[model samples]
Target: MNAPLDGVVVLDLTRALSGPYCTMLLADLGADVIKVESPAGDSSRRTGPFPQDDAEHLYGGYFQSVNRNKRSVVVDFRSPEGIAAVRRLAAGADVLIENFRAGVMDRMGLSYESLQRDNPRLVYGALRGFGDPRTGASPHVDRPAFDVVVQAMGGLMGITGPPHLPTKVGPGIGDLFPASLLAVGVLAALTDRERTGRGRFVDVAMYDAIVSLCERVVYQHSYNQAVPTGDGNDHPLLCPFGLYRTADGWVTIAAPRDHQWQALAKTLGRPGLGDDPRFATNNARVVVRDQVRAVIEDWTSALPTAEVVDALSAQVPCGPVNSAADIYADPHLRIRDMLVELEQPGSADPVTVAGQPIKFAGAETRAYRRAPLLGEHTAEVLGADAPPTTDR
Candidate 1:
């Protein structure tokens, strides 16, 4: 039952996805994450894939997915008393995470400088569109940003889809990636505090994180004078390292190395293709990527997805392109505990959310509790003596 962050208390003043995701990871690792929400509650509470029968429409899957294993304490941030209550929570917390605009926390008089005075060892983390002025200032610091904005601006969208048709990625990596980096930064800051006995401000910008995620584009542009553009599913550097069409569905195949390429050629009953002058080396294959793709698809298009996987998976990296339904039915993911079932707040039916990816050797890292209802823990956390506050 003992987890890595067993004794750590996190005052989570984040809404939507980014900050909540960071705190969710901490909460999964056994941190006492107290989510401080405004009276209206997190915006995600209303956004949902709601059950058809639930007329009252409690919290939706979007809210539940990232807010699990945490306690919620709703406070009216505009009220002086509510601010005092947050200060009390922050004073007793080991970490405070927020994803509001740069000056929002400072205007509320709850900046890291103000909180660290009460708890010198507190790790203050901020996830923002640009970055906090305390770390570095930018012209776009005040502009609001979303997943699409950062994905487009950070070069991910540019290299995502087919040529001349850039596409946004399916997942919200713009926000989630920054959140992940902030979590690591918070832990690193906490580690440093053990020696220096001082906490520090950690900031992760959505734009910065996306740029870091697309690190390859930077080096390639510099070294080759190549502005990376979308190349469909095929990798620019490696031939036959992309999705291929099977008879029934699509499957990804990655066999760029010589031995793997030879094995793939042999498996497809085309061993001579591996030694052919135009397809012999990886560079040659890349130079003639369309021909390589045609050759591979020519073999795969005759077989079902399962058959293709069975034929090449043992020898090369290959997998079917799984949809949500496919993932739900996948025996491998089920055995690995990647799909977890949790009870809905109001409905009798249980919903399945993603399980923790980081597996500890002996520690419990699963989602132990459902997402809390709005203001569910306000009284328990603030104590009976605390002043009454609006829970809108």
Candidate 2:
């Protein structure tokens, strides 16, 4: 099926996690994303969890996973000729994105003002730690940031992890969220440009995005003067909305609603407890959450995790704790096309990466294109004037 962004062109000057991830999404949706790298290539190409049997390490998992479905063109934009080539590309591009600290692009002579002069309908998207000064002034505008830094400073860590010791999340939510937001911004700008005949500058700050993700922190403090802190595995407001220990492993169950509680009570073979005064209403149960935990665990602690899930599963919102191996073994992934296989650059065997979650009903875009090697498309994309491939 033809993708929605079939004819769009994107000039990707960003590297590392956040920027590359945003471009990857656009490419997955069928945008012609041209990843422009420096002489040494994107720094992420060096990060590897390579296959043991591979002889020639073309690139690592970290880079391949995020850079798939795009063409790579290495250009040493530091040289005048290289920057001119990139500028020529910008003149005909639909969107240009970057994650450099503010002022770096201006210094390189490819600022929004310079590029938009050629293409008035060009969407310029900037994803940064503190954001560009052109959009808003930030004290930390010049400072660089990564996933852990934003997670800590953006109120997420304040209300995550154990009570006193705030911990970073397992995935790179800081980078991913801001990247997703930037992708949204690019799409929105493109939509607006169609009507207004002018493209706008889109900016997303990592710190701001993280803080917005934890809106509970804002409402709790504003509405009740409650500066929220991480409450461990238990949800502070919803009783029985947390992890529980099963006989063999753990399962998460959320039965906070009255009907769900009743169903759970019946499932646990304690039907009368559904209407018991102490645990009847949600507010009442919150007050005696410990007793609620004991009641559920008393039933669950005897059953294996699989048995517990089978018993409470569809009736109550419950699921077993899953690991990477569990996800690999789950048939739901294969059925849904949520796991995609790609050629491992150097290994004989292929590798698997998580597939795009966004689905366009009729447009079946399950194209699992392998990521391009550094300057792999330089000759084909840039034509005869292109520098020798060995130069990269």
Candidate 3:
């Protein structure tokens, strides 16, 4: 069956994570995405964790994670002919995405105003470290930002981890979050274009996106003037919500509601503790969290994680904190098809990768193509049935 974005065509002038991730979302929905890169290639191509025998191929695991289901075209936009080619490609595209620094596109004569003149129905998606130029410069705008930088500058680092030492999240939360917002903007603009026959600019900033993710901190600060402090192993507002050591491994227990907390107390053979003034309510429990956790840990520390899981399943909400090995061996993941196996393009054995998170009842969800080698589709993308691949 045809997918939702079957007829959509995207001109991807993005490199690295954020832009590529946005296009990949469109491609997964069956859009035809053509990624345009410089002749020197995306810097990510040179990133490590290369394949066994194909060190020459510019295919790094980092690049592959975000670039699947797209064709690639390498063109030197610094040249007059190259600028003309990109404009030609943009003329026929449903969407045009770029993540270059401020003024770079306008300098090359390929800004939204210029491109929209040719393709008025094109959704122009642009992303940067901060809000668009229309907004005044931010303290961190001129300096480059990755996930860690946003985490630090956008208040994520202050609240995460222990009180004395702040820690950044391990993943590319900054890049991925903005990419998700950009994807939503692109789709919204596409929907609007269908009705109005007019395209618009979709801009997203990494800092803004990160701040949105950390909004709960703002809520606490605003409501209580509490100046939220770090809670290393417990929930700030809820009781009995933290990791506990089991006989074999670790497990997390979250008894957020009053009923669940009472039930957890009963399951541990200490129902009377719930009546104690110090542990009577969630707010009070937070004050005596160490005493409450000590009691729960005393129960969990003797049992295996599975036993604890089974007992908690019958009593309250609880689950084991899975490791990579545990997740790989999980039956639930297989049943839900959260992990998928695909045939590798150049290797004999199939490669298993994380599947799409968004599931639709009737729509098929799968990767359309493997990640492209650098300029893998240069000839095909710039070939006949198309205009000359140059501009300026």
Candidate 4:
């Protein structure tokens, strides 16, 4: 089936996570995402959770997950011809994406300003540590950054994990969040182009995106004159809305609403506790957060996660704290088509990656395609006249 972005051509100059992820979403919808890799290929190629049997090390899960549904052409940027070939590709492309530091592309002569002159409607998408100077100046523009740095500086780590510990989130949300926003920005620019007939530059900073993700911090500080810190599995304003220990494992519970709280109180065999002024309203419960936690755990700690979920699933929002294994075993993900299987080079059977979450009603979603091998599409894309290697 023809997808929404079938004819859109995207020049993917991103490496690692952010840029590739942005293009990966586009490719999943049928965009022709041409990933231009360096001589060494994307560093993530070696960053893996690789198959134990694959001694040659091929590519790892990190690269495969985000780079799926795109084409790869290894290019050696060291060669002037390679750089020019990329510029030529940019001149005719609909979109160009990169997650380099602000000035990296400009130094390579593939700056948005020059490329836009050739393809006036090209949507220039950049995901950077700070931001592109075209949009705004940053003091740390020259500094390199990664997930940990952004998570810390953006106030995410400050409010994440336990108090005073400031732990990094398990997943690279600092990268992924900016990438997702850049995809939205690129689409918005494409939409605007339909009217103006000109594409605009789209910039998303990792730091800025993470800050936006923690928007609750802004209002809490302003409204309550409070400095938010990690509350240890509990919410600051909402009471009894956090994780509790179960006999087997942990289960998350959120019963902040009055009726839900009352139901929870009744389920715990203390219906009178729901009516107590100290715990009647959500506001009151917040004032006695520890008491609420102690009360909930008193009942939950005796039950297994599954039993707790079964009891509270209907009236209260609750579920087990799932691990990767639990997620794979879940029937809900299978029913929703959230797990997809595709070929693995050395594995005996196909391996699974996440399925596209964006769905179209009544339309058959595209099947998952494995990520391209390095330079796999070089011959097919560039043909006989293709620059003799080095489009890095």
- RMSD to native for every prediction? 1.3, 1.5, 2.5, 1.5
Model 3 lDDT per residue over 99-167, tens place: 987678999999889999999998999888885674556665666767788888777887778885788
Q: On residues 299-355, what C-alpha lDDT tens digit does candidate 2 reach at each position? A: 999999999999888889999899999998999988788889998888989888889
| lDDT for each residue of candidate 1 in 108-201, tens digit (9 for 90 to 100) | 9998889999999999999999999988998999998999999999999999999879899999999899999999999999999999999899
**All candidates in order of lDDT, best leading:** 1, 2, 4, 3
* Per-candidate TM-score against the hidden true structure: 0.97, 0.97, 0.92, 0.97
Q: Which ten residues in a row have the lowest lDDT in candidate 3?
A: 383-392
Worst 10 residues of 4 by lDDT: 383-392
Candidate 4 residue-wise lDDT at 125: 97
In model 1, which runs have C-alpha deviations exceeding 4 angstroms?
Answer: 364-367
Off by over 4 Å in 3: 135-140, 275-277, 343-346, 365-367, 384-392
- What is the TM-score ranking, best to worst? 1, 2, 4, 3
For model 3, what is the alpha-carbon lDDT of residue 5? 89
Which stretches of candidate 4 lie above 4 Å from their native place? 390-392
What does the lDDT come to for candidate 3?
0.82
